[model samples]
Target chain A: MANQDFVGIPSQVDTRALNRGASDFQRLRRGLLFNYLILGAGAILMIVPFIWMISTSFKPQAETVSFPPRLFPINPTISNYIDVFDRANMGRLYWNTTFISVIKTVFNIYTSALLGYIFGKFVFRGRDVIFYILLSTWIIPFEVYLIPLYLMTVQVGLANTYTALIVPEIFTIYAMFMFRQFMYTIPTELIDAARIDGAGEWYIFHRIIIPLSKAALFTLIAFYFMWNWNDFLWPLVVIADQDKYVITVGLATFVGEYWSQYGVIMAGASLAIIPILALFIAVQRFIIEGVVLTGLKG
Target chain B: MIQTIAQKFTGRRSTLRAAEHRFIVIALVPTIIFYAIVKFYPIFFSFFISMHEWSLFGNVSPYVGFDNYALLAKDSLFYKVMWNTMYRTFAGTFLGAFCSLIVALILNPIKRGSILLRLIYFLPVMTSVIASATIWKWMLQTRFGLLNQLLSYVGIQPVAWLQSTTWAMPSIIVMGIWGGIGFTVIIYLAGLKGIPKDYYEAAEIDGASSIQLALKITLPLLKPVVSFVLITGVIGGFSGGFQAIYMMTGGGPLDSTRVLALHIYDYAFQRMFMGQASSMSFVLFAIVLILTLVQFKLQRVDWEL
Candidate 1:
């Protein structure tokens, strides 16, 4: 029954009842065939752009601009990729992005989980008031705070630095709230048992709570990494030096600088997408779970 | 005698409670401080900056109370940007949510390859906006584009998708829907899973067609999910137009696709009009807050039904 819930299909009993007669069975099969045809076609439409992206990345410059553009390159080459790496400082861009993404993801997950553990497990003075204040911050979009944050960064003399990129992104109210929701499901008895064993609060948290909340932790890590990796606007606003640019910022500026270099632009884009696509495939299930938890709860 | 005993026990318990409270404070200190400095402070500062004649390189700017707001009221570009923002928000939200719901309903009945299909659909959401926008820009190119090539087979004229003022916003909307529908479909699928099968069975016994079962049972039950998608979609649509616009069109072809977020970006960063940009940000914030609250209030009424 639980499996049925997850798969979201009719139960065997319902199916058997519906498939009583030969004509009904045939009609059911026909309906399913129709559904598959529509779904398959839609899937093709969804997948084609990505396929086109990869194909374009491999195409020579001439083929990229050829009239009535071909879906597949007539004579594919690695020259575009070579040009992107050689001139675009692709390596530096990757390093800057990876360093920021890793540090930000680690700090964000740890802080959010710590706050969530406290909010979920402890009864402290002004807890509700504090939590609600944190919740209210989620309503204030980044655009509202962007200029002041830039000013604040400048005042602190951190503008155009990695500190500017990483610090402001380390704490998110949504991640904290998500961890709190996950922590609520953990049984209180486990904590009580640890307390009875005379474990310190920090010890209990590190040894017991952290290990038990692995799923939520992984979810947060994957999401935060992707977000920081792909973030453009703040990076664009704050970082002026090309050497410090993240992948998205680098790619965007590259396009602006060389708008007519279609093959090179496609190559850079392909390289930018590969890491995220790999991450998605590796943790695809958890990504879906995270989206369901966040989206449905909204 | 019993009162004294109870008092002794309570006194010891209160000490433990105090210890736990201290622990909570210790655990939460970093998060709270970070939020205070980074999140809370900036919100108040944004409001403060909106009231001043601020610029990029100044220690202080003279107060110009509501002058920026007044300027915005008379600014024609601000109104045009707001209209663009509204157009994208409504059109994107409606199309994305409606298409996702339909896709989810169709996928819910299929047992084979459903997971793979869902993953394929979600590829765009996983992709970086820069890359996706780049691909879209290429595909939407006037003469040498793939979309135009495909349309030619059906005898349709080649359209300058991202080049023309009239077509640019719709092009952005198409990309927005394509990128957004996957996540919404996943949410709707979850909602569909939560619906009890007994309702469908009962409806089928009563000779309810698939369409009737969907309209009467599925749609009503999915109200919460629909409302959730709509509110988030609106918020994302309003605030999240910057990346796509920046990468694909840069508010392009005569600023026809320049949304309010991009407008603020231009004023604050490009033109260095910090005060005016701050004012615009507040206006955008106000609109979003009202829309969100109205959605929640309406959803509450819907739930009561």
Candidate 2:
């Protein structure tokens, strides 16, 4: 009966099934090719504006306002770049941004990791409660804190100073949470072994924990550097001195002052992007990991 | 003798526990204190000042309970800005997430040059808001703009993009999508990567069509990721929409692009209405809190998986 039942499934059925499968495979392959074509076109759309910016930056002022805009400059010139550097004080903006970003990144990584280690490893009274309270602070937007924070900074006489620019940003709640999540994956045995060897808590943290979590540290560095480098609002609010202004605020002010100077503005914008773009391209993986890790966990 | 020994052992353990507690406190106090000073104190202070009549550079302001709140209630621009904010949040989040999902789906099957495409898409995100918005603003110029020029090639008349109030918000929304889609793509890509391949293979063997496979298998499986992207997109749109608007529109062509954050900023800094701005800030905070709670409820479902 089993043999008869098997035979009842016709050879024609097998052949038809095979043909359908073959056609389905062909359709899928065709669909994938079509998708690639669409995605290729989308990629061009994504990249053209940047190309346009660079092109405009290189164009002569006359050509920037020409009737039929050119994708590439008709008469490319370095005058815009020269003017931005010489007149707009690009060098000062670069220095201020780099200095503040570096200082903020370093402190952010250290404090975030230290607090993360404590939260992940320690058992103390009110640990969960304190951590939850800190986490809830993430919901409060910077606008909510803008008034009092500004007032506090002003009262302390740190307004318009690099100290104001770099201090408040260093202690971020998100980075602390990220580092804590990263630290949770680290085994307790490693710390225990260090402690057994007479290592103090600070020694174990500085040596074993920090070294083991280099990936997370690097991730936070890239994240923090980009954030601080691109921060506009806080710096705009606090820093009144043009010499102290970060690249973002300086560029914004440049835009306002030179609204019609398209070529110079584009040039300034291009230069401002180069440092962070280089950083991003170099550490793209870490940035992606940091973002993904936070997305999944948060 | 036994009692003495037990006492000594217990005493030593208690001291060790005390030392551990000390270490914990020492390691954690600075961060907790800093956070309290920077974050918590300002939040409370903001609330306190919201109830007062304050001004920029003023040391003391008379307390007027609910007066600022009352002024906000009567301010018609406040309602308009709220509407603008909600519109941008909903429209931008939807368009951004949808476009990113499509891109992710397309790029998922392409083994070649996927990373390169991702890099290209993510470039705008890496660029500063000022730079990107500068380029966008120039492109959205009514005449001789790149966008208009491109439209002309299709035999379409040039439309005033940022200059017209009707088109201004949409223009910002479009740029918002462009700059934001990369983040959504990357997140969705990560989500796509998490979907197991064997399921697809099994479905193929069963003669499940590609669209069916996507609808039945992929969509259902990616629900958690979709929710994450949507919720975060909305949250980000509410809080951070100010930068782009500030750069591109400066809250007009008629305040069409004025969002809550920009409104608060204008009240506090530009207009020097600190008390009114603080009240508005609390309202924004309340909205964010409600949204965040909703996200938590949704995320709990994701966590169960």
Candidate 3:
């Protein structure tokens, strides 16, 4: 960092610039070091729960309640995981959840795109009214919908069925709203251009609009997938059969039943968490950027 | 930007041809019907259910107009639950906002491995609340919890975090912050991204310190996003915490951790007091609706002050 080896007489301005450059360099380094220490500590705090959960999952039952806790197991084992599968029907939970989440997400995204396209692109009577009505429903909390929706499910003979799980949530508003906003970015001229080419409406949607909407599409897909995967409340209220349980409900019940069995329960938690986390981490770049993108538009 | 485009759509409605009109009708008609049945009708039916003595098994459900709401007004436990809900909502939202702002401020400056840092922070946000609460419950465990073990290094004794009435709500609130901070941080970061770097460079040329730069340059500009996070966070907080509380404490330790969501679920499902639960949900609905209106009004006010 030394600049004392200058061959000729340095101009006053050059010395000031050099001094400022060195100070700026030091300041930048200081800022980076501060960031590392503070953010590093914060990041560790954030993941400690996950690390502990994973660590506990590998521990023996006896070690779980031991006086002095160990971050890593002295004798790591997979017994807790086996116990989760054996006792909690973790595989069935995974299958049921996957089936439900996939269907629900598909329905949610597709319907929202269609409706959003209609509202955002089309010029029709009462479009704004209809769109705003649907948008307004976004404010109503799911808690308000829980009881009556459950009762309605039973009344319609859809109770305890996968239909109950997916039907009530088929037309989600938030994603639809997002799609509608995203639709604005698609020029009206494109639709008009397609129309002039004698392209069918659905053709334009499938070939053009859908393809053009990859940005919002991927982001909303990632988010809704995660939300559907982690959804606990509605599923918990509607599905009562033990075999029909989703992962969140299964985990809740598992934790309740195995309240004191820290190791196996943590294993169950791990099983419930890992697939979604893995999926998220894989597509995380899209998600993080998508959040920033939608955060503004939303 | 959104306003202008939306206004353009209003002022200049495209002349619809038969096929385009059909497409619009076909897509929207069923969706409107779906919304009416699934979303709108439920509110009315829930109101209807609220005015009666309803249950899962009983057949002789008698109508009792306004009684459920009246009952809630008088019930001490309902009051406690309201207090708990407000306590959790305000504490969780505000604290989470503050922490996220700080994290985002510190985080926005770093160029290297920022994504990794964000990913680590967002770990819990991706994890199911039930799973997060399970891990939190174990960590807050009195005998073998990680928290107590860590606290012991400073000569602090083991505290029954979920068992003590005093500590239980705070514990849940802290957990709420943990589950939520990453999300709000992303919002703040996005807002931070909107700010042009020229303001900072100009201010720095005038010898503004980092703290002053943050206060004078960053915060004032970031007000809209800050309030957005706080408003949305508070709104969500009212109806949230069910999965977490259900897993962690089950509204126990003297119902200290009980919020409106948990209480509503408990009454309807466990106790079969569907009428009362519906009424409580109405209360929640009103609170959320009011907050939303307030949000709208706040947004309308130019964020100058």
Candidate 4:
């Protein structure tokens, strides 16, 4: 009967140790609550200005400049939206930005994808040499090359044209690197299978590679579109004519024309940001993966 | 007869390899040509132009072989701008990264409302610098600004934020941090998310306090992300600060904000000293390269996470 009996281990008899652990847990939990409240307040502080911008965009000019400012527009009007398109020539700027974005996206994706495909899948002579040069280009800041690029654009009759704006960015090494890393994940057997079926490299890339690489491509598209849309420097340098001005340049002009119209500037910014925001939201899932993947690779 | 047929087929196979090379060339041609014409050729041409004292007028630009660079060495503005750029980069990068990490760490411990916080933090990053600059410009206005209005509440006099030489650069730094914190937060958030919950649980079970847990586990695990942010923060802050200075201040208020970027812009665009600008750019480029290398060296080993 004694042999049949069982008792808890000696460690379990240490009730004071158990009490201390519970007390510590309670303290930590309380501390966490205070931390969370403070953090939330900080977050709200960070967000208020952005909300203010959107709110100001809705209000009338007088209301926008009101003492202490309003959190929400009292009488929100569509006038700023209308003004963005009608008075500010935002429509023209949209076209310019869209044109640049579309061209740059297509060119960047295709060129980078192609170069990445070759570099990733193929083993050819001078591959390492070429890749080394490409890597070297990553560290070379665009500021170093800006004046030269502008001079070259002017020399080549590309100045004052969209070509000048889009052409230089087509050789996006980051995109190439991204695609190369993604392409490495794809099994060689898939390619080999296609090759056995008498498929050419072009057919293989178009039919096989493109279809399989949707996630990365979308990430690239979203990223590049945002970049091209928001770019100020290159467009400022090359696109001299008003007609060639992208949104950033056009917004600068808007400021010059309506220097006092802060509401209108906000309106223009809202308009400019909407498409990129939409794109980011659309590809939100993939973007996180792409970003994390890129970080790890780095 | 079989040997002869095999020989003929081998000749055709060699021809097919040749054709493959041709196809590869064709596929690569457009990118190569565009890259050379658009990117590389311009870089080379800039080097050529850097040798000449070019003017906007029809005056012949005589070759000035390194004279522009030599002039830069003696130019007080050049040294001053370089100094300003370094200062801005150091201050902005370190402070920005530090603030971002703090925000990230604080948010990481809170399970609820983190997503909303992230979006809030990311808004400034998504907004245009020009647009944000305008709003901040209004808020920081000397006489009638909200910041001064708030200062009045604290019994302080209205101070010039952007107009004064003493305050101009600091104003830019304040704006730079405001504009920069969001992306930095996002980067840190992403970094924080990667830390496993088990690490914290283990620390808790071992009777380690929150501060000790953070120091031992979180900070060590987040080093790589920290390093990345630090290096990129420097680069982004330096370049972006220069940009804001150029666009917003025009490097004005006695050129207190005349960082190298604005200096380069003025030389290249306003003064039409393309060669001098190019030399300045190269000098800045060298500085950036050195700074980046130094950062990488300092943090390479610490990038355990």
Better of 1 and 3 by DockQ: 1
- What interface RMSD, in Å and to 1 decimal, does model 2 have? 13.5
Ordered list by DockQ, greatest first = 1, 3, 2, 4
If you score just chain A, what TM-score does every candidate get? Answer: 0.86, 0.85, 0.87, 0.82
Top-down TM-score ranking: 3, 1, 2, 4
Best prediction by DockQ: 1
Summarize candidate 2's per-residue lDDT along A1-298 as a digit string, tens digits.
0000000000111112223444555656657788779899999989888888888899988988886888778778999999999877999999888988899988888888988888888877798888888877777778888999998998899998998888887777777776787776688977765554456667888899998776677766776787778888888899998888889888888888888778898898899887898888888655455444534443
Question: Candidate 4 — which residues are off by over 4 angstroms?
Answer: A1-32, A285-298, B1-23, B109-112, B193-199, B295-305
DockQ of each: 0.42, 0.30, 0.38, 0.20
Candidate by candidate, in order, the iRMS in Å equals: 7.1, 13.5, 12.8, 14.8
DockQ score for model 4, please? 0.20
User: Lowest-scoring 10 consecutive residues by lDDT in candidate 2 chain B?
Assistant: B296-305
The best candidate by TM-score is: 3
Residues forming the 10-long window of minimal summed lDDT in candidate 2 chain A: A1-10
> Which runs of model 3 end up more than 4 angstroms from their true locations?
A1-27, A286-298, B1-16, B301-305
- Please give, for residues B184-263, the per-residue lDDT of candidate 1 as tens digits: 78778777877887998898889999899889999999998898888878876777678888888889888899998898
Cα lDDT of model 1 by residue, A1-298, tens digit = 0000011111111122223355445545648778778888989989888888888889888888786667778898999999999888999999999998899888888888888888888776798789889877776778998899999998899999999988887777777777777776679988876655456778888999998777677766776787778888889888999999999999998888877778888899999999988987888666455444434343
For model 2 the TM-score comes to: 0.90
lDDT of 4 by residue, B1-305 (tens): 56544654666556545655665677667766766675567667777777888755566888999998889889998888877887787887788888878887876655444555666676666666666676676667665456786788778988987778888888888778877777777667666766877898888899998789889999999998888877766765555564467556778888888887778778888899887888887776676688778876876633111
Task: Estimate the Cα RMSD of every predicted model relative to the unseen true structure.
Answer: 5.9, 10.0, 9.6, 10.7
lDDT of 2 by residue, B1-305 (tens): 56544654665546545666777878678777888899889998999989999897657799999999999899999999999999999999899889999998887776556667888887887787888898898888777678888888888899998878899999999998898777678677667767877898899999998789889999999999898888877876777677788888898988888999899999999999899999999998888888888988878733112
C-alpha TM-score for every candidate: 0.90, 0.90, 0.91, 0.85
| Candidate 4 CAPRI classification by DockQ | incorrect
